[model samples]
Structure formats: C-alpha cells, structure tokens
Target: MKAQGIEVLLVFDPANMNYLTGYDGWSFYVPQLIVVALAEPEPLWIGRGIDLNGARETTYVEDANLYAYSDRYVHHDHRHPMDFVAHILRERELDNARIGLDMDSYYFSARGYEVLRRQMPHASFIDVTRLVSGLRSIKSPQELEYMRQAGQIMQRVMKVALGNVEPGIRQCDAVGEIYRAQMRGTQAYGGDYPAIAPMLPTGRGTSTPHLTWTDKPFVREEACILELAAARYHYHCPMARTVFMGDPPKRLVDAAMIVADGVQAALDAVKPGATCEAIEAAWRSVTAPRGIVKESRIGYSMGLNYPPDWGEHTMSLRPGDRSVLEPGMTFHLIPGIWMDDWGVEISESFVVTADGYELLAPFPRKLFVKP
Candidate 1:
C-alpha cells in the first residue's frame, strides 16, 4: 500500500474486524468500531467501553479510545460513540488522507455514515476490501493447522452420527446427536453458523440442497443428506454426505454415485494454475451426462471463518476468477444433483498443494444404510 500511495486503512465491518483483530462477536447490535492503520504511527482502535478488554487482548493495535455509557442512563446522558470515533480520527490528523475502507464487508448505518461524512469531509475513502480479501484468501500455516483439526473433529462426529442413522430416526434427532458429538470436544464453540440447525434432509426434503432440519423421519429406500460444519479454534471445515435410510432406491443411488464421481473429478482437477472454472467444468463433465444441472459454483473457500465474508457466488467460478490454486488455500468442493423429489450432495474440504490437493475430511462417500 505504501507503493500505491495509500496512507491509512480503516476497517469497520464485523468480518474485517475479526480478520484483523481477533475480536469475534456479533457487532450489528453493538456500537460500530473501527481499526485504523496509519503509515507511520502505531495502529489505533475506536470502540465502546464494553469491548475494551476484548479489543485490547485480541488486537495488535496499542492505542485504543473507548466510549462508555451508564447502564441506567438513557440516550442524552452519555458521550456519543460515533463522536468518539470521529474525534479519534481527527486527533490522528487523518482527515483529508487517502483512507482505504473495506466497503465490501463494512456497511455503515445511515446515521453512522452521516457522522463520518460530517467529521471527515476532507478524507478520500477508497474501497480496499478486495485488497484485504486477496490477502486473506491464502491461509497462514497456523490457520491451515486449525482447519485441519476442525476437519478431523468433523470426521469423527460424522462417524458417530452416521452410525446412529436408521429409518425411524427423525432428521432433527440425528442432527441433535451430531451437535452433541461436536460439543464433546474442548474446541467446539457454536459453528460458524448454528452447528446443526439445517442438519440432515430426508426424503423429498433433500430436493433443496440447503434444506433445514425437519421433524420428518427417515423411511426405507429414501434419500438423506447431512450438511455440516465443524469449527475448531474458530476455523471451520464444511462437509456433507448423503446416505440412504435403507437400501436406497436404485435411482437415488445412481444419482449419489454420479455426484460422487463429480466430486472426485473436481478433486482431480485441483492443482496449481487450475482455474476455478476449470474445476467446475471437471465436475460438470461428470454430472452433465447424468442429467444433474449445477445451479451454483462447484465450491467455495474455507477458513477461520467459514463462508468467509466473500463466497463462491460473489467470486465467480468463471475464467476471470483466476484465483490460481495455491498451496494453503482451503476450499469446499460440493457437487450436488437435484432431482424431482430428492437431491444428492457430496461435499469435502481440500487444501491446494504444489502437485495436488489434500483431502481434509476422510469420511466415506458411499450411501451408508442403517440396518
């Protein structure tokens, strides 16, 4: 950024906040905070008093200005949070500076935008979200290790959950068992999202790839799909597997096998210099013959934050997304087949390498039928 003449960087979104400072909390309802990096000086953090300790402990920023409000008081009685943030920016003499703002992830509320506009009228705000995302796309060694651990845990939980699968079990019950199994380990917090809410889909419900868990129980020869995320040390590894309640109908099994083949083809295509479009095409080659039309990208990135603020949809799987397959880049390959009354999905996490990719989860892909 120094070579580009960028003087300061301001990060305000929750996702960016977590990325830069390990301050992970749902910040929507809370007062918005900003992490500012000046070219010469130490970084500064502007946040509410409630988050002071957390911000200090997790962030690299040493200078922190905090605004507090009395718990018993109403609006007019305390110092305004936005004003404090503005004051910090002004005190740093960053007004009129070329400031990089993470616009992709940071959306200012109407009032908050007005406050910044009034306070820093002279500053030019440039969108730097892409720069930051580009930097974040590749994982650090520590981040990769955490994701690998997350994958291991997910694989273990999958074994337990699949072993308990049977025709009589409700989808929700199976989901509950998986969640419980995940929680047994010390690393399990909540998932990147809810751990197991939209757990496994059964019967006709499998038609929707992201079908939420239902009270519907599994029946003989029906399709059942389990989509899950395992989070360890805040990193996530998302995976899915489809199975049968009994001996699955021959058609469903055939579809599952086709999807599995697509997944394998995608994994085989993953290597340095391979484009995302090329990977998607490999999967499409296998699925197209079986009449399974892909409506979404073949895969997406995985990281400390699953579904990292950017997703496969936002970053297309086209030729332009020349995000070369690099070592330490973790992604989820999800090849799905949508049918009239059911769908089959097989998702696995993989980390790109110099020659090939490493499969993070070692779970079985075949239809596991419960006796």
Candidate 2:
C-alpha cells in the first residue's frame, strides 16, 4: 500500500487476499475482505462468523486481527457486513483517509461498495483494481514450484483426455476420465480444483471457444479440442490441444503444423527487456502470411486464482500492450485460430526467464491424432 501511495487498501479480490495473507477458503460467496493500512504490520481479515475458523486455519495472522460478523448479515435486507468494516476503519481514524478499493473485482459486489461508501462517507475511495495484482504478476521461486507441480498434474490429465476420446465414446465419458485424473492428479501430488472446468468442444462447437462437453458420442472424421488446467496450491498451468479421431482434414492438418511453428516462434521471442507486443508480432508474422487473422489477444498472464477464470488480468501478449517482459513472469500463450468451420488451439503455460521462457509442461507441442 505504501509503494502505490495507497493509505488504506480494501482487498476484495480473493486471489489478492490469498496472496497477501495466505487466507484461503470458499468464502468469496460472502462479503469478505482483507484491510491493509500502511501503519499496520498485519492485515485485518473480516467475514461471516461461520467462516472465521477457516480464516484462522488457513492464515498465519494473529487471532486478534480476525473479525467476524453475525450470520444475520448473510442475506439480511437491512444489514451489510461492510457496515461493521466501516466501524473498524473509523476506530482506526481511516474513515477520512484515502482508501483503495478493488472496485472492479468480481468478489466486490456493487451493493458492498455502496454500503461501504455510505458507511464511510468522509473517506476518499481510489480505484485500485490492479494495485495488488500488479505486484502478483511476477512469480517467486516457491510460487513457480507450485505451478510446476500443477503442470505435472496437467500432463496426466491431458493423457487421460487424449486416451479416452474415441469413436462411439460419449463426450461425458471422456470428461469423466479427465475429472478422475484431475482429482487423482500426479503420483507425487494431489490436485486442487481448477478455476474453470474442462472445455471439450467437438465438431461445429470447436469453431467457437469456451463451450463445455455434451453426452453426444464422438464420430469419425471430426475434431475435438481439449482446454484443461491443473492446480496445485491454487497455482495454475493451463494446457490445450486439438485432436482428430480419424484421418484429419488436410486443411486442419496443415493449420496444425503452422500453429505449432508459430507458437515456437513466439516462445523464442520471450526474453528479458522484450515487450509483450513484440511476442504477439512474432506469432502473427507466421499466420498472417497464410491469410489467417486472429482477432483475440494471443495470450495473458497466469498464476494463483479462484473459480470463473485463471488469468491474472495484468498483461496481454498483443498489440497496444507494451508491458515489458521480466524474469519470473508467467503467461498462458493461447495461439488459437478459430475459423468459420473449425478452430485449432495449441497453447502453453510458460515462465519468463533471463535467457528465454521455460514451458511448465513437458507435453509435445504438436496436435494429437488418434487413428
């Protein structure tokens, strides 16, 4: 908070709270937050009384710093938990201070903000949506280790997904195997639930992204794309690949090789002092020449996260994004090309190094074909 000149920071993003205080639980469904003031050494965690035990168990802070409201505030029409938070801030004389709130955060509800605003009318609220997020962009050595473990889990999960997808096999059956592998994870480590579910889009659905699986059985001469992630200690590594059940189409086959080459070229461009825009340019140079123009940003920063998405919402590997690359920064390079008929996505999760980028997974960088 001092580095950003923020006097008091109200962290409503669960990921930010987790990063700051090691407080982790399924309490984001409620109005919970971590309050940080420059003068205080430890952050204050507040939430429902029922979840107070979770905060104590997961966090390393002193018990005195934790506060809990009554269960009456859960869905109370007249009461809000922020009202109690404002009372604490007032006690600390922060009601008139410059307070930073994660206004754009998913966990920070519109009603929560309004209640806090009314409760602390004299306080000046600053839009510090990415304040803590910027600090989390770079991974520490321990954080990288967790991500590597997650990558190992993904390798096994992908293997199950690749093996079970076949003709006459229901999409849900293959997804079931993927789920089982995710739960079982690697031999050395167990898996945590990913931020997003597995995306198994086949045939026409592959033309569009973000579609989930169906009970429909696979057929001959069709394409299926698997985009899955594995989590270890809430650190994520997302990997995706497209597969063909039978003799794949010549056009898709050719596109697959081109996409593979483009991804490698982009990976090679990852070095310290390089710009994010330059990396996207390297990938586009290969595909644009072939008349393939992808409108979406190629990649984004990735790290510890909760459900709904795994992206860090910090930097994008695309034009207009001049965020300079630094060592320890991690990104998910999603070099996907979606045409009117079909789409191909072969991606990687990598960490930026001094010399180049290191891929999190040891999986092959080519499309998978099962005959």
Candidate 3:
C-alpha cells in the first residue's frame, strides 16, 4: 500500500478477505469489509451483527477487532451497512487518511463504494483492487499442499465423471456424479465447496465455454466440455476435458492433439525468468499455423477464490503482461477453443517449479472418445 500511497485499505473481495484474516463464510450476500491501516495492530473485520460471530468463528483475529452493525442496515434501500464501517473508520481516526477501495472486484458493489465515498469526504480513495491480489500469486508451502489435495480430488472427480458418461445418461445426472466425487474427495480428507459448479456443457453447447449442464440426455457423437474444480480449503485446482459419446470425428482428434501439444509447449516455456506473455506466445506459435487463431487468453494466474470465480485476477498469460514467471506461482493453462460449430477444452492447473512447471493433477490430457 505504501507503494500505491494508500495509507488505509478497505478490502471487500472475499478471496482477499479470506487471505488477510482466514475469515470464511457465505455471508457475502450482504455488506462486509476488512479494514487495514498502517498504525493498527490487527486488521478489523466489520459486518452485520448476526454474522459477527461467524467472522469470530472463522478468523484467527481477536474478538476486540470485530465490529458489527444491527439488522436494520441489511437489505435496506436507503440505509447501507458501509455507513457503520465508515463511522468506525472515523472513530479510529482514519476518516481523513488516504484510503484505498477495492473498486474493481466482484464483491465490491457500486452501492457500497458510493456509501463509503459519501461517508468519507475528507479521505482520499484510490482504486487498489489488484494490490492485494498480486501478493497472493505465489503460493506458500502450506497453500501448495492444499492445492495439491484439491488436484487429487479433481483427478478422482474427472475419473468418476467421465466414466459415467454414455449415450443415454442425462447431463444433470453426470454432473451429479461429479458433485459426489467433489464432496467425497479422497478417503484421506473431505472436499470443500468449489468457487464454481461443474461446467458440463454438452453437444454443440460446448461452443459457449461457460454454459452449465441441462437435464437433456447425451446423444451419440455429442460432446461435453467438463470444466470443473476440486477445492481444498478454498484453493482450487481446475481441470477440463472434452468427452464424446461415440467415435469423434477426425477434426476433433486433430484439434485435441494440437491443444495438448500447445499446452505442453506453454508449460515448457515456464521458468523463473520467462515472462507471462512469452509463455502464451509459445502456445500460440503451435496453433497459429493450423489456422486456429484464439482471441481469448490461454492461461491465467489462479489460487484461493470464492463463488463465481477461481482466478487470481492479478496476472494473465497473454500479450503485454510483463509479470515474470516465479517459482511457486500457480496458473490454470486453458488451451480451450470454441469454434462456431464445436469446442474442445483440455486444460491443466499447475504451479511454477524450479526447472519449469508442475501439473497439479496427473489426469490424462486427452479428449475422451468413448462407446
């Protein structure tokens, strides 16, 4: 924050909230925040009175740093919960400080920012959404263990989910099987809820990358793109593959080979001194000659996340992203292509190693063509 000239930070991103204090809950439906100031001994957690205990139970911080507002502030059209947070900031003598707000995050609602801006006229607010996000790009040993566990869970999940796919099974039923594997995890440990649910888009529906599953039955020759993550303690390991009900056409097989080769080239490009864009360029070099010009990014930095997203919004494996590769930084390298009539996704979640990068899950990186 000192680099950004931000003396006080108001963090509303749930992933960041979890990173800073280990506070976890589904209470993001309403207003809540984490306040960080230079002079403060501990960051403060402020939220609804009903959920204050939820914070206390989840966070390692002392009870003295927890503050809550009454229920009247919740769901009120005119009244907002951030007003209470602003009041506390003033009481703590941070009202006139150079405040920073996480304005670009999914959880930092416009109404919340408006209220904070109106409440603190004397304070300077700068957009610092990516400040904390950048700090979490590199994983510690413990965080890597949790991600490795998540990867193990995903390997089992992919095995069970793809094994159950057939011509007549409902897409929802297949997704249900994936969910079971996710919840059951390994026999050693249980799984945690994922940031996003199973994205098992079937048939030509795969052309749209983000569609959820439907109740429709799979037909012969149809394809399903399985985009899913198995999380352990909120650290996500996403895996994706294209599964076909019958013998896939040669076009798909060729595309699958291209994607796999491209992903490998990208992985080989990852090292301590490589740039993010250079890694993407390595993937692009393999596919560009095949007339596969993908506009979407092939990979991104990822780690601990919340609902609706699993990416660590700081860096991208794309053009102009100068962020150098570092050991222990994790990424989801998605060499997915959604053409007009078909789509194929064979992806990897990996962490940067001393020599190169390590794949989080050892699942086969191939398009599954089955009976």
Name the top TM-score candidate: 3
Per residue, candidate 3 scores C-alpha lDDT tens digits across 88-121 of 9999998998998878887778888889889999
Better of 1 and 2 by lDDT: 2
Per-candidate TM equals 0.84, 0.97, 0.98
lDDT of each model, Cα atoms only? 0.68, 0.90, 0.90
Candidate 1: list runs displaced more than 4 Å.
Answer: 2-5, 26-31, 63-83, 106-111, 186-198, 219-221, 306-320
Per-residue lDDT over 61-89 for candidate 1, one digit per residue giving the tens place of the 0 to 100 score: 65434333333322333434556566677
Superposed Cα RMSD, model 2: 1.2
Task: Tell me model 1's lDDT, rounded to 2 decimals.
Answer: 0.68
Clashes of each: 0, 0, 0
Residue 96: error of model 3 in Å? Answer: 0.6
